[model samples]
Structure formats: C-alpha cells, structure tokens
Target chain A: MDKENRHHLWLTVPALLSIGLLFSAYGLFGWTSFYRATPGGLGVGGDFTFDNYLRIFGSWRELAVIGETLWISFALTMISLVIAVPMALVIARSPSRLVRSILLFTLAVTFLSGGVTRAYAWMVLLGNKGLINLALVHLGVIERPIRLVFNWLGVSISLVHFLLPFTVFTLVGAVKNLPLSVEEAARNLGATRMTTFFRVTLPLLSSGLVVAASLTYSLALSSFLFPLLLGGGRVRMVANHIYERLFVAYDIPFAAATSAVFLVLSFVVILGFAGLERLVRKVVVR
Target chain B: MNRRSLERPYGRLVPLTATLACLFLLLPVVFVVAFSFNDGAYFQWPPRGPTLRWYVNFFESERFMTATEHSLKVALIVTPACLVVGLPTAVAIARGRFAGRDLIATLLLSPLIVPGVVTGVALLALFTAVHGDLGLGRLLIGMFVFGLPFAVRTMVADLLGLDPRLEEAARNLGATRLRTFFLVTLPQLKSSMLAGAVFVFVEAIDNFSISVFLTDERSAVLPVVAYQYIRDFDDPTVAAMATLLIALSCALVFAIERLIGFERMMHINRK
Candidate 1:
C-alpha cells in the first residue's frame, strides 16, 4: 500500500505542482484586489477595503465596459452557433467525400492557425485598402471605404471566424452520436422533416450547443487582441480594461478588482448555462 | 416516382450553408496569402504588379527575424516540457480509478475554462507580489499552464482507448510495470503525443494574449511583434509574416493529418 501510494504520488506530482502554482497565483491576485492603493502611485500598501471593488462597480464607464464585454461574448456565441449547426450537420451527413474533406480541411486550417493569425487575416480583408473596400470601389458600390476595421463590426466578424470551427466540430460530434434511424422513423411516420428536426435533432444537440456556447463566450470575454487591435483602442472589454488598469494606468489594485469581477462574471455565465443545459436535457429527454 | 418530401430544400440549404461557412473561415487566410505577393506596401486591389519584395523584406528585417527566433525557441522548449509533465498525469487519470480522480482532472483542465486574461493578470500579479519582473521565465510558466491541460486531455483520451489486457499480459509474463509501460504502452501513445506536442507548440508560438502581459524588451515573440508592427505600420511585411505562419500551420496540420488523420488527432473531446 505504501509503495503504491508513493508511485501514485510520483505520477501526479507535476500536475499537482502546476495546479498548485495557479491556485497560489490567483489566490494572491484575489487577495491583492482587497488591498487599497497607496497614496503614492508606486504600489498597493494599505489595509483591506472594498474600495477597489466599489470603484469598479461605481464608475459608469467601468459598468459599461462590463456590459459591453458580456454583450459581445453572448452575440459571438449565438452567431457562431447559428452559423455552425448547419455546417456541422452537412459535414456529418454529406454523401460526397470531396465535400466532407474540404469542409474538414477548412476547419482544421482555421483551428490550427489559432486566434492571432485569424484576427490578422480579418485585418487584411477588412482594412481600408483591403479586398472588400477595393472591390466596392471598382464596382462603384460605395464612394468611400467603409470603416470595417477597429470597430465592433470588425471584432465581431473576426471573433465569429475564430469561434466557428470549434462549434462546428462539437456539433459534428453530437450529430454523429445521434442514431439516424430515429430521424428516419419520424420521417416515415408522417412527421414533416422540419418538425422532425425541431422536435428530435435540435433537442438532442442541447449538451453540445451548451458546451460550444460556454467555450465561445469565455473566449470572447477574455479577448484582448481583438478589441485592442480591431477596436482601435475605442472599444474596451473587461480584459482590455484590466490590462489598461494594470499597465497603462498603473493601478494594480483596480486591475486586480477588475480581474476578480471578471472571474465572477465568467462563473455566473457558466453556471447559468449549466442550469439552462439541465432544463434543456430534461425537456429533450422526455 | 416522386421522391419523398421533394418539397424540402434540405440538400440545397445544407451544402450552401456549409460552403458559405467554409468560405468565411478561409477568406482571410486566402487574403493573407494573396496579398503577400502584392507589389504595393499597403493593401491594394488590382495590384500594379506581383513581387516577392515583402517576403524578402520579412526575411531581411532584423527585428522580425529576432522575434521569430524567440518564438521558435520558446515553443520548442515548452512542447517537450508539457509532454514530460502531462503524459504521466494522463496515465494516472486514465488508469488510477482512485478517490479525487475527477477533482484532479478538473483542476488540471481548469486552465482551459478560465479566461486567459485572468490567468495572465493573476500570474502577473503573483510575480509582482513577489517583486519579480515579467520576462521569459514567467512567460514560459504562463504558457505551460495554458498548454498542459490540452496535452493531458489529448493523452488521457488516447490512453483510455488502450486495452489494459496488453499490459496485463506483459506483466504476467514477468515484465516489470515500468518495462511494460515503456515496451508496450508508450508505442501506442505516439500519435497522441505527436498531436499534443504539435498543438502545444502551435499554441505557444501563436500565443499573444498571455504573452502580451509578460513581454519585456528582451522577450518579444513573433505574434507580439507582428501586432505592434501592424499597429504602427499597415505594410504588407506583416502580411508576408502572417503568410509564413499560415504556411507553417498548414504544414503541421497536413503532416499530422497524414500521420493519424485530422479528425482523430484534433478531436480532443472525442469519447
């Protein structure tokens, strides 16, 4: 028993150490949020207070930043889902091998490139002299280049691209799990295809949809580059705000406070989705 | 004979939507590739000519080359470190069947769920709280945290698929536990290890958000440098660099796809 325990401990030590380091880091971060900023702007030094937290909530600007972050995150998740479900279904059920391989290759390229390159690609496409603008000019569709980059529109487009592959693959897994015979039986029994899809297929994908949504939401909320680069410093999300507070403003306490609120907000969103998924599971299973 | 429910446009709609979505995903990538050859400095349509100047410029620039070197160095180091740490934990998760196993798994995977910005800031704060400056060491730790969960998750999935009987049979024939794992089990895990290594390497190289916070003057990675360059200049050199990245990523994906197939390699959540 002793030897076995020792072996188990040895196997787990690296993972334990990594997680331990994270907990300690975040714990100190959470603790630092409570410390009042010293009068001099050098560092935090005062006794415990809720001033940092209050300041984050009390300011109208800060409140709007949080709201915008949540809104963008939610919008990206929903838009990606709307776009991905059909794509996933086709990928899973397509009869043509070429179509399947092409779709899979597209997804693999996007996923492997990760978010930074994807964002950069959007910049190239959406810039003033970019393809869209240039095409619009030659066709006389518009007299001037539309402001696509450095705004919510640019951020949303890039974010949706960044998010689509994950959702599609996830839904592919869910769609593959579904027994095709059930759908076939429903169609054979006089149910319209739309009705069969709505009553049967969509509900069965609830868990996958939930997981995808949560993933998309958190990524969007945590987005720094999108808003920083695409937002043109005009759009500020929670992550960007925290970064500014820490580095630009040099307000460590305020940044810590913002981080804390952001963490809580993410937890709330996740738990809310989990609850929604439970409700969905109950309705779908019955 | 009329087809059943020919009224429904299911065939047309599904393919149309899938094509559009794939186009949306690839449009930017195609843009990057094409624009790199544009003769103009800024993005322009109906190019005056096609030239390799920007690609040449990207290779010629000292700063860009240095950033690429740093990124390559960091990714090369982090990949093996992640696998070294993650592989054993993956085995334990797959085979232990012990108390707190689920909790351990959750904790290990928590970095995936946590916001990268939060993790970045938390690490920043932790380092500052200890009076340490942000540099290569902190950056590696932050990235290691980000990549470890992915490595472990992939390995765990691969490990769970193995039949225990193979190892058991080996053990029964007088092979020691360590010897069984090395001679029998490790070979089976090669594909997963490769997948996880590639993922970690790509992620570490492509990392911008967490590394953004940790970057000092001496430690700017390619993505960070590219971001700063784009912020200041709208040149096609960044486009050329981005094209290089797209090429590298495609090569990696193609290599892995040929090795183990794309879907199996990347479907980390596959049951």
Candidate 2:
C-alpha cells in the first residue's frame, strides 16, 4: 500500500475499536433478552424464547410506558416549539445584539448545568413552599400550596426547560438562514407583516422545525432525571422504568427487552423525522 | 396611525413572550444559586439570609471533598483519553482517502442516538458478566464511551473547517506527512481541541446515568454521591456543590467562546 492508504488503515483503528466495544455490549444486551430470565431473577436462564417481546407488546403495563414516553415526548416537543420559535426569532433577527448575547448566555447556562443540578433547582422551585407557591399565596391567588412536585406538572415544566435550549439552537439556525429576500418581495407587493410571516416565512422554516422537533423528541424520550426527580415516582418514563425493572423488580430480561425495544424505537422515530425533514426541504424549504 | 395599526397584530405580544421565555430559561438556575447560600438548614418557603454557610460546610466536609476530587481525577483522565481516541477517528473520517468513512463515523457516534440509560444498562450487564465488581476501571470505560462522541464531533468539524490549502502548501514544499500535520494543521486545531477538552471534562464530571449504574460504595463519582446525599438529606451542601459546578461550566462557556468564537462552539452541539 502507498503512504496515504497505509495512513488511512492505521488511523481507522481507534474508531473501529471504540465503536466495536459499544456495539458488542449492545449486542450482548440484545442477545441475552432472547432468553428467558431465570426464576431467581436478575439472570437470564432457561431456554431461549420470544416471550420477552411478546410480554412487552401484549402487556398493558409495558405498552403504557411506551405510549407514555412517546406522548410525553410529542407533547413537550410541541410546547417547546411554541416557546422556542419566538425566542429563536428574537435571538436571530432582533435588532439588539445585547438581547441576543444575554439570551444566548442564559441558554448556555441552562444547557450545560447538568441534570442533577437542574433537577434539584426545579424541585426547590416547584416544591409546595417554593417560590411560585409563595408568590401565588401572597397575591391571594390560592389559599394553599398546590401539589406541583412529584407530578406531571412539575415534570413537564422542568422537561420543557431542558428541551428549550436545544430547540432554540436548531430554530436559531433556521431563522438566521431564512431567505429574507423572498419575504422582502412579499412585503413590496403590500403583504402585511402577519401575512408575510405566516405565508413566506413559515414554509421555509418547516424543515428546520422538523429537525428541531426530532432532536427535542429524541432527548425527551431518553430523559432520565427530570421524571425521576420531579415526577416524584408517579410519572415514570421508560428510562426510569428500565432502572426499576432491574434494581426494584430484579427483572433483567424485562429491562433488556425494554431497552432493546427503546433503542429500535428511537432509531425509527428519529429516522422517520429525518426523512420528513428531507421531504420538506425538497418541496419548499430550500 | 398607519405604523401603529400595521404593527397592532402582535407587536407588544412578541416582545412580552420573548421576555418570559428568557426568564424561564434562567428561572431554575437562579433558584439553584440562590438557595445554595441560605443561612438556615430548613426547606421552608423563605430561606434565611444569604450566607456562606453551605459553601464553607461543603468545603470542610471530607466526603464531599473526596467525591469532588475523585470526579475531577476521572474527568481529567477521560478528557485526554477522548483526545487521543477521538482525534484519530475524526482525522480518518475527515482527511482519509478511505471508503465507508461516513458509515464508520455514524457507527462511532451511535452511542449518542440511544438513551444513555440503555447504555448504562448494557454496560452494567457487560461489566458484570466480565466481573461482578464495579471499580474505577469500569466507571472510566463507561464515561469514556459517552465522552468520545463530543470530542470526535468537535474535532472533526474543526479539522474539516480548516483551510485545506495550509496543509497542501506544506506538502507541496516537501514537508513529511507527520511534520506537515504537526506544523501546519495542529496549530489551527488547538483552540477547538481545548474547547472539546472542556466539553469532555465537564461531561465526565456531570455524567450521572452511566455513573449511576457503574459506581459502588468505593467507586462513587460526585454526581452519584451528590444524588445519594440529596436522597438522604435536606441540606444545602449539594446545592453548594452544584453552584460550584454551574460556575465552572459558565466559565468554560465564556472561555470556549473566546477560544473558537461562541457561534462555532454552539455548532459543536448540532449535527
């Protein structure tokens, strides 16, 4: 082999080794699920069977977790779009750089502060005697602290905060990359701001929003801490359930089966969104 | 009259919503910082006067200090490992004249596509099969698996973004392949490498799902320990520790901004 090919061969080794180990681990995890879990629990023993998959799909409990995960991801992604698109517009197109920089800094802090701290922060904020409750009580809006923590309300708010920066980032890119000239032409033809925005701008933004929603949906689906912490054990998502199946229930086959299914579902949904994005981009976005 | 009517549709509404959105982004973070310095030990509605009690208490505590030190050590090690592994992977994908490089790159980054808890479960099962004990070795391996994706993405983008002519000019002048890479290419890539290193370091320290499963009584990282403390206690010490981490992350964001420009740094987050 020549110098270049030799270098290429050598350079590819580390990537292969790194990816190989993970794939094999996942392969092992997937391989083990095909077998029945031992009666002793936490161990897969006995003959191999398709019972795990059948159990996952046939049972209401397992199917509910799957349905809940998808529904929560979808609902939160839509809510995030409502909040994020306006912020993206401000961050990307506003005349003020000071506003942009401050918003960006807030996003960076929110995005990078890690799950434990963010979860803790929300607990402190949304707890019974927390800031919102205090303010509401003082204003006579309520006579008592409503239950927010350890429920859907708490989880949804915190999850939205977690999902916001990502959607904003994606939408910011879309907003900045907009074909402004086309909008300018619409305005020259006496199109009002609202008409120009909804007609000319929204179509162009569809692909970017699809990308943002895909990312947001995937991240929401995998969320571990928010539901675990803020949901107060009541709003358990698939990730939390997977953990419980092993440590609490000692059901290793179930966790493995669920996660294998989780992995495949993520690929299908994310890849489905990927195809939709291309279709949107092809039709009108570009 | 014309301008007022023309803008009446959502003029005031847009700015109001933007302001609320900004506040929402900072709301939880602001609370975390505020309560960290609370003078009291209670979880009451109004925390007492802000004081340095928790911060001092945290610093003086051995368990907290030890966990912090351990996490830092692991992060320090994981950051360099990522550079060593991810750089070559990035280079091969970006500059190599090889086929299936795209496919290889996708597979390398596949870990990010799945929920990390799945990987945590998989790694837990795999490590247990090998040996039923959790130690620094298994913990490091788990952290490294997740950290490598960030490093590869940043470095690959940086390497691809460089002016190809700089390296080509050196080659045309008969600089050896190794020499040309170090002399011409490495200089331009330094800032992004540092940026990627900061990311990997923070990720290693912040990683919880993977570490949550991998840690034992003897091998617990900060997040794992902090989580346990939170579960057991109602004090502000973990809050103090979290404040310190937030400060460190914010500083790194600023530092990275100065290094590679903030927009470029944010691009590392995108596909």
Candidate 3:
C-alpha cells in the first residue's frame, strides 16, 4: 500500500473505534429514548417510550428546580467575571514579583482542590459552629449564628471561588497577547489614559472577555458538587437535579429528558456565541 | 513610550489589587489546612490546641485507605487510557487536513462543555443500557470521556508547535509511516504526552461527579469517600484526606516540572 493509504488505515481504525465506543455507550445509557420502561419497575428494564420527556414537562417541581439552577449558575458566572476581570487586568499589568508569586500560588491551590473539598471548607466557614459564626459571635454582629450553610449564598460563594482561577487564566492570556504599541501610539497622540483604556484596551480585550465569560458560564451551569454540598438541597442546579432523578427517583425517562434539555441549552448558547464571535471578527477586520 | 508616564500610576495600583485577589483565592485552602490541625472537632478560628489526631485517624480508617487505593487505581488506569486515545486524536487533528476535522475536534471536547453531573448521568445511563449494570469498566469509561478532551487539546497544541519537516525528512529516507511515527514523531512528542497524562491524572483523581454516579462500595474512589465523610459526619478526617490529596497533586506537579520544565508545560497548557 502507498504511504497515504497506510496512514489512513491506521487513523481509521482508532477513529471508527472511538465513534463506535462512544455512541454505543450513549445508546446503553438510554441517551436516546429508544428504550424505556413504565413507572413501576425498580430498575432500568422497561419498554421504550417518550414518557420521560413528558414527565419532565409535567412536573412543576422539576421545572422550578431547573429554573433555580440556571439562575444560580448565571449569577455565579456574572459575579465571578465582575471580580475576575479587574484581577486579570492587574495580574497582566503588574510588575511586582511578590504579587505574581501570590497570584501563582492562588491558581495552584484553586486548581488542586476538588469541588467537594472546597465546598466542605466553605461549609466549615459558614456553618453555625463554623468560623464566620465564631467571629460574628465575638464581634456581636448578631446575637446568634446566622444560617449560612445549605443555602444559595454559600453555594454561590464556593462556585465563584472554584471558577475564579480559570476566569483569570483565560483573561490573562487575552490581555497579555494584546498589542500594546497601538495603545502607546494613541497615548502619544494626546489621548488620556482613561480614554486609551476604554477606547483601545477594552475593545481589544473583548474577545478574551467573551471566551472567559462563556467558559465560566458553562462551568457554573454544569457544577454539581458545590450546589449539592453547599446548597444543602436548597440549591439544586440542573446537573444535580438530573442526577437525583436518575439515582434517587430512578426515573430514567425523565432523567433522559433532563439531559436532553441541558444538551440543547448548552448547544444553543455555544452556537450563539460562535456566531457572535464570527460577527465580531468581521467587524474587527472591517 | 509616551504612555509610560500616564500608565505608571495605574501599573502601581495593579500590584496592590493583584495581591488582594491572590489572598482571596488562597483563604479557603489555607483555612482547610489550619482547621485540620485545630484541636476542636468543629472548625474553630483560633485553635483550642493543635493536634495530629485527625491525620492519625485518617490513616487508621479502613474507609479512607480503601478510597485512596481506589482513587489511585482509577487515576493510573484512566490517565494511560486518555493518552492512548488523545495522542492519536491530537496527531490526526494537528497534522491531517481532512473533512469534518473541526467536528471531530468538537466531539472530542464535548465532555468538557457538558456538565460533570450530566456526563456522570449520561455515562450511567449509557453503561446500564449496554451492560445491564454499572461497574469499574463503566466508571473508567466515564473518566476517560471527561479526561480525553483535555488531553487531546493540550497534546494538539504541543503537536502544532512541532516542526513537521523533521517527520517528512524521516519519511523521505524510506521509513514506513508506523516507523516514522514511533521513531521520529513519538520521541519528540514525549513531553507533550507526559504533560497531557499528568493533566488527565489530576483531573481524574479529583473528579467526584462521575464517581458519585458510578461508584459502588467496592469501587468507591477517594473524592466520593471524602465527600461522604464530610456529609454524614462533621470531622477533620475529611480535611486530613484533602491534605493528603493536595500533597499527592503537588508531588505530581513537581515531578512533571522536573521532567519537562514548568514553563514548557505551562506554555502547552496555555496554548
């Protein structure tokens, strides 16, 4: 065989194998509703039906849970972005070795700690007998400990902490790669520093902003351990809710529908952003 | 040069804010370590007295040991599997110009965009649908799905930076495609492959979402076990476990840096 054919053969085997493995796995997981059982079975043995999708729409509780999950995820993403952007800007522009080292250490810790461990740390801090309560009691901030654990606030705080490093890292890349010569040229032409930043730096950095925001948004949306542990069942993100339906409720059909909704939502958002990016690129070129 | 005069003050302000941001990020992790040493069972700000009981308790506990073992086993298996799939995928994407390349790349990375909970649920469903029940095989498959994309992306970046002419030169010498890849391409790709492997291992070891959905008592991983301890019991044992895992991750990171150099690996990851 020719070299091209030989290479193709080698590539084809693994590529086909991966596709088959992944799709077959998807099939087995009831990813498609081709196989389903009625509501009476204790396990996964059932005939195929669209009952799961119907059940998801029919249940107000499930709908409400999903709505709440989206709200928290979006909120976390927005808040983290608000905090992370300036921080990224600082890290990019800073000249201090001490400052850089500190930032590096923070990234290391954030990346190393798993979602559940971070949640537990927050739980300790926010719980009645936790650190925050102890400080509050000492300071007389309140007569008794405030209820912080197993709440939306706690969940948000932990999720933001978890996602902060990623936001900074992505944004830093965007900001650092930006061409500074133009900004300097604008300054030489008598533009004020503020004007230069708002007019030049921000616009140039917008691509990075979009990338960081979309990434953070998707990450927060899919986060489960934080909401599960920190939210204390008070905060049920879509992912966790789907998990509960599958594991606790054993409602495979409904779980499948929930998964489908998640997949569609993410796909729509991603495609929308991709289109926006294309539009932005065209405008930039023009 | 003109911007320097005006930009100087703003640059000075950056150090202060960056320092503060770093503090905020490190606070929780520092707290975890501090609380682990607190004499009180509950997390107290000022330690009543420092003690090593939690660490000792963690080591003695059968559950923690089993979970640690399980986590290590999964990481060992999952990291290599991810590399096996990811390296080839990277090679194909980075070097080959083919139809549907973008789509294939997207498909490989779809797991990263999908929520971990969803991945876990999807994998659980997929496993049961195919095998009638979940087992180690399913759990490993789920971990592979999650880790593969990251490995592939990192390796692809690494491969893109490589000089393709070197491989072409080897091919000109009448080396077969397989021989060229193994002798000429593989050695050059080692650092990238190692970096990808370490990345996958860390991700796999720390993952709880899939483990939660798929793990049984016999196959329970460390994160799941640590999570259970934290949930059912309020104790420092979880903290002790976290400390161990943190140490393990740091050691791996250090080893990777020693092997490939930190800057090189970071560059690949950033790319």
Predicted structure with the largest DockQ when compared to the true one: 1
Query: What are the per-residue Cα lDDT tens digits for candidate 3 across B52-139?
Result: 9999999999988987887888889989887887777787777666667777776766667777776676666666555546456667
How well does each candidate superpose onto the true structure, as a TM-score? 0.93, 0.93, 0.90
Instruction: Return the lDDT, model 3, position A242.
Output: 81
Tell me how candidate 2 scores on lDDT: 0.83
Fnat of candidate 1 is: 0.61
True-vs-predicted CA distance for residue A160, candidate 1, Å:
0.3
What are the per-residue Cα lDDT tens digits for candidate 1 across A1-286? Answer: 3355446646888889999999899888888888866655537787889999898788998889999999888989999999998888877777677877889888888887766677777877888877888889889999999999888999888888887887786678777777787777777788776787788778788877887787778777788887787788887888888888877788888888888888888889988988988888788777
CA RMSD of all predictions:
2.6, 2.7, 3.0
True contacts kept of each: 0.61, 0.56, 0.46
Better of 2 and 3 by DockQ: 2
- For model 2, residues B1-271, the per-residue Cα lDDT tens digits are 2555433333456668889998988887887888898887656655688899899988997778877877988998999999998887788888877678779888887787789899998988888778757477787888888889878887888888889898889999999988988999988878668877877887799888888888887787888888888888888888898899899889877877776767665554444
lDDT of the structure predicted as candidate 1: 0.82
Q: Between candidates 2 and 3, which one is better according to TM-score?
A: 2
Worst 10 residues of 3 chain A by lDDT: A1-10
Output DockQ, candidate 1: 0.58
Worst 10 residues of 1 chain B by lDDT: B1-10
